[model samples]
Structures are given as C-alpha cells and as structure tokens.
Target: MGDFSALGEKLKATRNKMGLSLSDMSAKTGVSKTMLSQIERSESMPTIATVWKIANGLKIKLETLLDDSSQLYEVKSIDDKLAIKDDDGRMIIHSIFPFSPISGYEVFYGVFKPGCNYSDDNHTNSTTEQLFVTDGELEMIVGQNTYRITAGCSLSFDSSEKHRYINNGDIDANVLIIVNYE
Candidate 1:
C-alpha cells in the first residue's frame, strides 16, 4: 500500500524541524489548527491552495512538501518520485535538481491540466522563462500573443511578461518550465 501516512508524518517533521508549532502556522497561514492536525495525521489530503499556504508558512516551495523520497540525486522509480494530482485545481509538481550552484536559473517541471491556468503573475526579477512541451498541446499566453505549443516544441520569452499556460489538449499537458531568476 502507498504510505500516505508517512507522507503526512514527513510534512509534520519538516514543520517541527523549523521550530514551528501548529498555532504558529495557524497564525502565519490562517489555516485552522484542526485542519492542519488532520492533514498531519493523514486524515485529509490538503488541496493545492492549502498546500500553498503551508509551504508559504514554512518559507519553502511547494515541491518541498511532496519530496518525501530519499536524498536528492538518488534515483528512484518514476512512480515513486512523481507527485501526481488529479484535481483540476492549480497543482505544481516540482523537482529541484540536487546540489546545484545558486545561479540565475530555477529549473522545474510543471503539468497544467486541461483548462487549468495558474495566476498570471509576472516575474519578481528580470528573468527569462522557457518551456519545452513534452506531451500534448498547450496554449501559452505571453503578453498579447497566444502561441500553440505542441510536442517537441520549445519557447523562450521574457519572464517579466505576464504569462499563463492553458492545456488546450483534451488530456493533461506536460511541460518543462524553467524560470531564470536573474
């Protein structure tokens, strides 16, 4: 059986390691103590919004919450490492490459499900955004232009432009999106 309980335990441990209490998180994230406790106990799976709140409260990325696997660079089975979400809500599954120098780039992978589009937030820094479509098709809106990206196609554009991704495909669209946080 998949150990979702262990996943909850790991999340709890990460929060405790940061010396944060449930009350502290509640105050910081506005998430109720009871809800957080249930999440920690594996009684409930947190939604994307709830996960965002917890990650922000812990001052970490959303990927950190799902990284219950072994050390970075330790190869594991694809099913063991991939964090999949079926909900149409905004879910960001990330894999931050291990032990890389802090440069201007932050690399990760994302899958925007059909008709799903995240907030059109511009970059916080002067940066470049690149995307390589791996499966299906997606419509990427960069400022005014909407480009149809198909499998094996790639795009690079200014990160400062207000951008959003939509899965124009009938199925989920997978893409590797890299943000150059220069």
Candidate 2:
C-alpha cells in the first residue's frame, strides 16, 4: 500500500491496453473517474476492495494486478516484522513470493508458537495447499479430515474447504507452505 507508483503504472498500462478511458473504466469498475485518475497518477492508494473491483472489471487475477515485480530474476528477504499474524499473533506467515500464474504457485514461511491455533477460510475451488514441517510438529485439520505432521514431513490437500492448524509441541513449529492456484 505504501508504494503507489508501481500499482499506478500497472493500472494505467492495463487500462490502456484494453482501450478504456478513465470514464469507461470508472463505469466498468464502479469507481469514479476522479478516483481512477488519482490512482493512475499515484496520488492515491486503492484499497483491497477497490483493487478487487478493478481486477474483476478487467477480467484479471488479483495478485497479477497487485504484484509489484515481474522481473526474470530477483532476490527477497523476509523479516519477522513483515509477517502476517493471526490468532492474536501466535501464528505468523511470511510471504516469500506472492501468487503468480507464471510460477503456478505462491510460497510462504510460517511459524506457530506452542499452543497456537489458527483457523483459515476456504480458498478458490481449484487451489491446493502443501505444507512441510521444518521443525516441531503440528496438527492440520482440513475440513473433516485431520492429520498429524511432524518435522521433516509434508502434507498436501485441497484448500477449498476450511482448515485449521494447531501446534501441540512445546517448541515453535516452523512450516514451509506452497499454495497452488492451478
């Protein structure tokens, strides 16, 4: 959200490629022309909902539009403070790489403290989630089925149903997760 220039550039390029003017885009996206102009000029930051609307109107994927980089080669480092937290910060997820159709998947590193329990909603019907426990153990409850995964083990399941993760270990549980949106 902080870097508006990249998003602005992408938005403008996509709109121009589709041969849509600001007014046409506004009507299609249900966003005002003034707001669209501001976004294109990098003077305003679009909220997640607004971005979703634009994606739907453009018939494009959310991550495709949100992705700031489409380079062939790059390196990224994750810091603890940049993690997405849940369950009152007991569980943290760091995005190694966001979803990209070119890559066919997104990568995340997660850490769950002892006694941590995190519940997540279902994803798209075609999505699958793979998790590899790097340290300690955790129980993954995918819909009605539950599985215990220990360190050095991995599990894969359809992610279209509700899922929950619980770390019963006394130590922190670390997992590498890949989400396939194919």
Candidate 3:
C-alpha cells in the first residue's frame, strides 16, 4: 500500500505495449476492469495476488512492475511496512529482493493466516520455487500433490504447473520463498 503511482504509469505503458485496454487486461487477468483502471490511474494499490495475476496474464516478471530501486549497493531489509496484504490481512507479502532479468531470481518473506494462499495462476511455467517455513505449518499443493512443510523445513518444486501455498493450521505461518525464473 505504498506510493505506487510509478507502478501505475508502468502498468499503463505495459498494457499499451501489449495492445490491451483495461477491459482486455481484465479478461486476461481475471481482475475487474474498474479495478484495473484504478490501478492504471494510481487510485489503487494491488495486492500480492493481483500482482501475480497481472504478471502472469502479461507473461512478465514480478519485478517488471515492482522494481523501484537500482542502486548498486542497496541496503534493503524485509520489513512489514513494505508488505502487500489482502483485504482481510490473511496473507501478507514482503519482497526482500525483486528479481531482475539479469539476476533471474527473487525472494519474498510471507505471513499467512489460516486459510490464506496464492492463486493457482500465481507463477509462470518457467520457474522454480523454494519455500522455507520458519514459524508455523503449511500445505504446499502442487499438481494434485499436497506436501506438508513444517517449521524449519523446506520444499522446492517447479512452479509452472498448478500450485499454491496454504496455511491450514490454527496459527500463522511465516515463510521465505525464493523463486528462480528460467
């Protein structure tokens, strides 16, 4: 929920480059046209899922819209103030490192309340995700497979196919997810 006017401009440019209008983007991303317009107009800040949807629908990297810094020696830390949240705050995402095309990878720290998760279309077909649970339990569902990852445990898998991370436990789940794009 930070200042994302720059992001709105970038989004407008990307959409124009793709020959897409708000309605077209809405069709592709499953986001509402009004919301998409609001995003394009800098009247709204998208949630993590919205970011993923737009990136996936446009077949672009997450950082294509999120990267705002280019310092050679940037001092960055994972802070909650930078988190993007769902309306209910069930899922919170803090981007530790925004992936650059040069780096081909990104990192995120996330907190998931019970029943919270990413949408099935959260990633592209040419990436791998490695997730480490630091606090509570999570169920990583991938292509009909459900893997339970506990605190201090990790899970790595291809992200192209159907996948999502859910916290079905009673407590909140803290996780670090590293995504490597091909």
Give the best candidate by TM-score: 2
Every candidate's lDDT: 0.72, 0.84, 0.82
Q: TM-score of model 1 relative to the true fold? A: 0.51
Among all windows of 10 consecutive residues in model 2, the one with the lowest summed lDDT is 72-81
Of candidates 2 and 1, the better by lDDT: 2
- Write down the lDDT that model 1 would get: 0.72
The candidate with the higher TM-score, 1 or 3, is: 3
Across 1-182, the per-residue lDDT of candidate 1 in tens digits comes to: 23344657766877676667889878877789999889889999877788788778766666666765654566554455456453356445565442121234666667777777664565777578788989888888888988999989999989888887877568767888777753
Q: Show model 3 residue runs off by greater than 4 Å.
A: 1-74
lDDT of 2 at 83: 83
For candidate 2, the TM-score is 0.60
Q: Which digits, one per residue and each the tens of the lDDT, describe model 3 over residues 51-76? A: 88988887688777776745337666
The TM-score values for the models, in the order shown, are 0.51, 0.60, 0.56
lDDT of 2 by residue, 69-138 (tens): 8564766667633789889888989988765434567899999999899988858644889999999999
- Candidate 3 TM-score, true structure as reference: 0.56
Report the C-alpha displacement of residue 160, candidate 2, in angstroms: 0.7
lDDT of 2: 0.84
In terms of lDDT, model 3 sits at 0.82
On lDDT, the leading prediction is 2
